[model samples]
Target: MFQDKGALISLPAADIAKVRVPGSIFPAQELLALELREDLKAAVRLIKDICEDHGVDSLVVARPEMFTNGPTTAWLHNRIGGIEDHICISDGRTVRVVPGMTNHAFFMRLGVEKNFERFVKLQKRCPELIRGLASQINSAFTFPADASIPTVILQPAEGLMNLDPAFLPFCLVRHSVQATFDQIALSGKIDLTENFSRCSRLIYVPLSEIALQSEGFCRYIAREIAAAFFDPTVGVILALPTAETAESDMKAGIETLVEALRGIPGGIPSVASHRIVLASQECPESFLFQGSRRVELVLHNSLDAWLHPPEYYGRFDHIVVAASRATDTRELYVEYIDHLLGRRPEFYWLEHLALHPNDTGLIAAW
Candidate 1:
């Protein structure tokens, strides 16, 4: 809507009909209202028509591989003054779009060399920009990193311990404050409420508390996590480590504990014959764990580790967390930023960090 390339582009009616806009600072109702506004509708129609003429027939915008720079997408976004989110669907296709600019670019356009006085002057003149940006900040939680795939995130702060046994296979909320452990009692062999009491009190527990937690508790939680992953029907396991501990410490802890899980008598190894694949930032490694020679290891410290397709890495039917509570407070903020960038959460929720990669001076999370 913001651009006028004069090239007609018709979108697949089906794809346009399926486009979902999540509730951000604005609620779903509010976003719908805005979408229905005369101006926006007109803009969208024009944009759609332009896209259709250029053979952009579907809402599916062609994209480069995840993490690989898309020259065309970037060029279009820069000219159009907007950001576009591709919603991927099954069959390895992207058929949905969330498009908007959060005014981040405006401030960024001022350049690092700009003075604080200049920012103050600019802010006074751009009242609408300020208001719009504020709205964007408040609407963060509505949309999550595209749920097009059956991907689930085990946040570091709240591992599989926070989830009920029944919902282990289903998707979960981003924040644990929402209805996580509300219905704790279940008629299962293990009393989930009884075992992980300390872990479930808050979204995140300190490292000291984690250390004090019983091995039985860890093992029990681990067992349940393993059970969720190794369902006999499941093909491969994607183990994503979300712990906020030190890089070395969290990596070592996860690798060791997972190995232990495999060795646990009657645990995952006994239940399923799926391979466990881990993404690391370093080269791939291999080792025998509990007599199962079905683990594929690779280095992928980037978030892309979790975002990439299962088949690209190998056989994988489900993704589970090797998640632990983040130990570092800074990691919490970094985690939020990652969520903001990947999922486009409301901005104000993370505005405190100034979106500065190096807000801590010494510890920049770029």
Candidate 2:
């Protein structure tokens, strides 16, 4: 995770039962609510239980380009360390070990439009599939109704492939599938060989631009739309960095984000979220009082500004916010929440789904 222009610290080994690394997960969108380290461990335990109950050979894992080089990757690959049986694609083979993770370089694999499109085309040919698998390893996934997809990932060349516009449809779709792969599966093939390509900019929808009046289940898009789609509500956590360096970087983060998310309908504009940075910062509990005001807030948790709480906090009951392994040292996280819940669950609830665009072949450096 790049915070204030640098890397976060990796923590020592934890006693937790399991640690799940989602492919290309954005903290602002998918963190657990305030809770203890035990809570996170418990979630992982359930995943393990279900896998074992079903006589599963292994639980599929995935990561995308977005999460590749960030703080989360460092933590999973190096910091707390991986489980002995954890299967991560490494150096052309599936390695079921944790200690040597750093050697292969870490990544959250994704099943994006391009990857899937490519995989299907080659499914009929055994030799081509084997050749491609030798160079690039992959696994299958499915998701729930209006839920995000799940995926299994391995190592990539660069830490990650950063999309210039920031909003990556391929990355998004891959995330949705990875998140829900355990629950749902599509019925037919998505053939986009002619209209779109992984190398292309955007995936073309088969239908014309039909104005969507009703809310569909897409969290990332819905998040931006929260401002216009429903009544956009946001929560902001303002604090000054204890260190001079971090303070400057955090200020830039605010400015950059405000600038990037300028004119989208249902989006939480900058004027709404205030900027409050000071020399003295308070504890997470002290900031909790302001929770009811906005849907989400972003905070700085560098060594200079640390959050000393028993666990991570989230925006609504549906979401979870936890520190990335990177935070073990810096100890921090950030988010954008949605306020209106039960009142209008459709508009307010963030189901954490993704939109997989058409994919390209063997990308992000195998």
Candidate 3:
């Protein structure tokens, strides 16, 4: 029932002091003249007259600290407005504001039962739960024989070109959830490719040229891995980028691609068939499983693992099983990796399925 332009224009305190007169701004004459404007209505009329005379748009008053007396306290408790109207007068012309935290606490105290019931409704209606609902609705998901876990690679494509590609995955997760909430329900298909593809950084070079640079090559691999993850129709594809690209450009592409897949609400089971690959060269042989890469970084602090994963493992059971089985937390996982095999082996794959519950759920019951 309360509606306006919904924009607040703030005038500085200095400007307010220059224009306002203490008590004369109120509609004392009009309130006395009009019989109908009594009690709470009289305060509303006073606020309107002040807005008209003093050009006072909106005023946000912070509460004075405990055991302190100030002009603000007197102005607030002087009964110029109604206790029911939050000790403020509002007739669309002006709003006498109070500290939001104080207002919230006061209202919560007055309507505890109503507020509690509304909180329960909020939990049930949370938009993030749409992901869970989407998960429940789409039950058709299966795993490949080797049980390689599905992964989504996200990269910056267009508008997201400015953002670090590595961050795009988390952004995709958040944005897709938001989109689901906006629509009030999950759709059969969620597309976010166009929005992510916009970027200022792009380059053109031959595939062979890019392969010469290891960093650029690794980045290209990240992009290919991201693209392959989202193409539900194809389990894997080995195609060289016709043009050479910067590591950042390739990363940007991967960021957007992965974000699109990650944003899919309820989860896209089709991604399960795809195994992530970031090899320098595309092996000519067509195969589902050739090998996977495991990256290990040694950091003194646990902060890096949370903020920036030492190695971003895209749910590879082969890699995760060994890591998860060895440690309870990510910090421990890093430590376990550090302690393993003083002499690093040519192939990092391990044979143990130590069988974590979440891992077991991912696999088909034998």
Candidate 4:
């Protein structure tokens, strides 16, 4: 069943079902011929066993998280904490089981130093690494060969772990494109198309701290780009605070987001509550509105505000455009990076962005 110059990339064969999955590449065709998830695992095992029974060396398995979860619907995001994926390697003498991280580690070998701070746009920042990650997952649930089982017992026994902070951010980044489109739908001021690529159109611009940042101008810039590239409907998602956010020594995060978002053309701004105290009792979807037309807030509660789940973040197309609202650029930059790293995305489809502290509303976004 082997051929030359095909999409399926095979590695050296090994004896006993011992399979070694490569990180960046995997056997996609072999898995898909089978239609069931559980059967998919069995097919993988069968292939490995066939190679092993033939006295082959071992099965090289390359995996990714995207395959397993890409088809997954927006839910509690099971990837948060549990065995989302796994690979079973069995040699005539033994079977070794491994989790998805093994594949991440595989890609990491050829991986570049990803300083999330430096990545202004997700894909623009690191596409190959990300693509490799997604491909692995796709390979996981590949269709099984015909006659595959239809039960969970045959699924790969990859032990799961609590979803990694890095995992959620990465997932959110994947959905960033969708979030942008959704933002347009919710704002209602723009008629944006649903098709968008994460980072392909959106870019993060971090700047120095400055008081009186005018987000109004920032929206104009984002609109100009959207109109020029895709459509005038192209919208921006920002996370900044009110300029008057008065906390000299301490950072006023939500307030800053309010200001940056306000800078956008027809952007609605709101305060994120703190200390388990909701700034409102509704989600941003309820309070956020187009222009000064404020909608009824549905999730201003302190608890939800504090949680600020990642799904909510994905519900809109926005950028992490921060203005320090700080008088000093140097100090603001330091605090800004610190906050970006400290705050992981509440949803799997969004990632933290690095914005400047001194940037005035519009100026900072640029």
Candidate 5:
């Protein structure tokens, strides 16, 4: 069916009969063969149409790795008459089969100075030019880099007070119309100006009222918080349910968080052994405590040091604090845990400043 009218064609009769047998069990194989044949026909038609439109009499096939002896190249030469006369093949060290054109002429046309000898000498100095060109062409289209910034979650003042001192420096307070950084600073109980100078350590992120109302936005924030647990630069993340957050939304957020955490090297088992704390105001229905052994679930109104006692909190490697009103008690819980664990000296920022001062400037700009 692919051949022109009155054109002579060769066929392997046995092979054709085997594949074209009626009610064959190998339906998938037959379908694939048909699809491949149709695709080749389409490709040939497109190429012929392009050539006809441009009024081209010959085709120049330039390939960095094509071999004259290769069956595919030989078949292509046979299928397209006079294609062999215009073929150009390069094997890193040398270019061959230029036909009417000389190596020196080709090199000159390609912007190489002087002659082919100069091109050869340049290739010797930069071997990557010959090898990487094909790979560069192959990878011209790719997925864009992940440019989205981490979502910032703003906790209540009481919640912020309870945050682990180790994580305090990395915390970013969101300054919405509902609550501003200046208003929080005036409280006096929490020294927002001294500790968080120039909005450096504890920065204030201004979020629009629309963003705060978005459930999808809230879920994205939850995923970011969950992702932070695995990030070396990020310390403990304190997340509390806001008034707008529904139980379903909270469950969905937790599910996303759990999925992200489970992607760690040793999976959930390793995460359970880590010094991680998950504190929430209300228990989401999606949180599964089934297989987790080292995870301790503590239900308390306030994570006050005196009420819980040191030994009880000290026993577990990972703790999940669930309170009746988690938003109200989150800070106290984090504060209590921070006090119990004792703040370890963090020099990540100092190290970053020393190593990548420009990157730090970029971060500050962001």
Candidate 6:
């Protein structure tokens, strides 16, 4: 296994036994309060165990993106008590706050720009994901109280409709199917023009758009994408790096992708077994071979050329394209792929599921 200096102590599956907390203890008004209470207890226990085992006195907990100015901080403080002073909450940036301290005080004490510089330095030495996940397993217990944390929020330039052209062919296919069904109803005759037996799913990742984002954000997005459709059955096509893509960005993207794959429940072994098609000009050696596990990467020069003979013919049931915009070139590429596939793409609603709103809009625009 590839190891990072800041890696968290691995939480074994066998060790995570379910604790059945009685529902009667929780208020009847809140349906999930009991479950939430149990989960929090488990998280606190895990944190305490890890801290004791490492002989660590104070720790910084990275705030998850979801808990924006929520009651998580108060809830955690209630459970952990005076130790809240020892626990600092970070928003994956320069902003770090203790339990009672307001966001304004923290920023006023440490200037925004200076804090960012310090954060950059800290990031260079340690992986943010490790630090973040180590303290809080799934969700961060702390929430940003009053300060608006400046973080990059990547958004697709175009609406969902114009994002991927691969769905165009699928739309046409569906229209045809509907028309055929209408004809059959009118004439009372069955006409099977197309066979809807074998279907394939295409997961198109817009690498160019996500390349420049922070490594933490990249990992988050990669994990979300993988969780949604990282199966052997799905056909994934990651768009090639654009001219504006930086080498560091590509490296971060690749590393985060691998991390996301391995970070999932089953780890590298489960990911390595999946037959994923990575459509790119060249495959990076680091991505293909991570420690002892080898991932079989299928590379192609251009989307146009790759779809010429359609490697996995009549095998795609879903086509997922992760792009910021449907550029003319990208549209053409998707169109070509759709043409080759010769099937209607089933539209799966995936808006705002993978990428969430962030405060760093200006940075992302730049």
lDDT of 6 by residue, 176-232 (tens): 334422432344322111211111333344343223232333443445345434353
TM-score of model number 4: 0.19
Which lDDT values do the candidates have, in the order given? 0.26, 0.23, 0.25, 0.26, 0.27, 0.28
Q: How close is candidate 2 to the true structure, as a TM-score?
A: 0.23
Q: Count the backbone clashes (under 3 Å) in each candidate.
A: 25, 51, 20, 83, 5, 17
> What TM-scores do the predictions have?
0.21, 0.23, 0.16, 0.19, 0.17, 0.22
Pairs with backbone N, CA or C atoms under 3 Å apart (clashes), candidate 5: 159-331, 162-331, 162-334, 162-335, 281-326
Q: RMSD per prediction, one decimal?
A: 19.8, 21.0, 24.5, 20.8, 26.5, 19.9
Model 2 weakest 10-residue run by lDDT: 205-214
> Candidate 5 on 131-236: residue-level lDDT in tens?
3221110001111123211211111111111222211112222323222223323433433223222211110111222222223333434444445445433322
Cα lDDT tens digits for candidate 2, 105-128 = 111111122322333343333332
Q: For model 1, how does the per-residue alpha-carbon lDDT over 232-277 read when each residue is reduced to its tens digit?
A: 3222223333332213332343343344334334433222111222
List where candidate 4 sits over 4 angstroms from the true fold.
1-122, 135-251, 261-366
Q: Write the per-residue lDDT of candidate 4 for residues 255-278, one digit (tens) a residue.
A: 332344443553222211110111
The parts of candidate 3 lying over 4 Å away from their true place are 1-57, 64-74, 79-102, 105-366
Error of 5 at 207 (Å): 27
lDDT-better candidate, 2 vs 3: 3
Candidate 5 is scored at a TM of 0.17
Better of 1 and 6 by TM-score: 6
C-alpha lDDT of residue 30 in model 6: 28
Give the number of the best model, judged by lDDT.
6
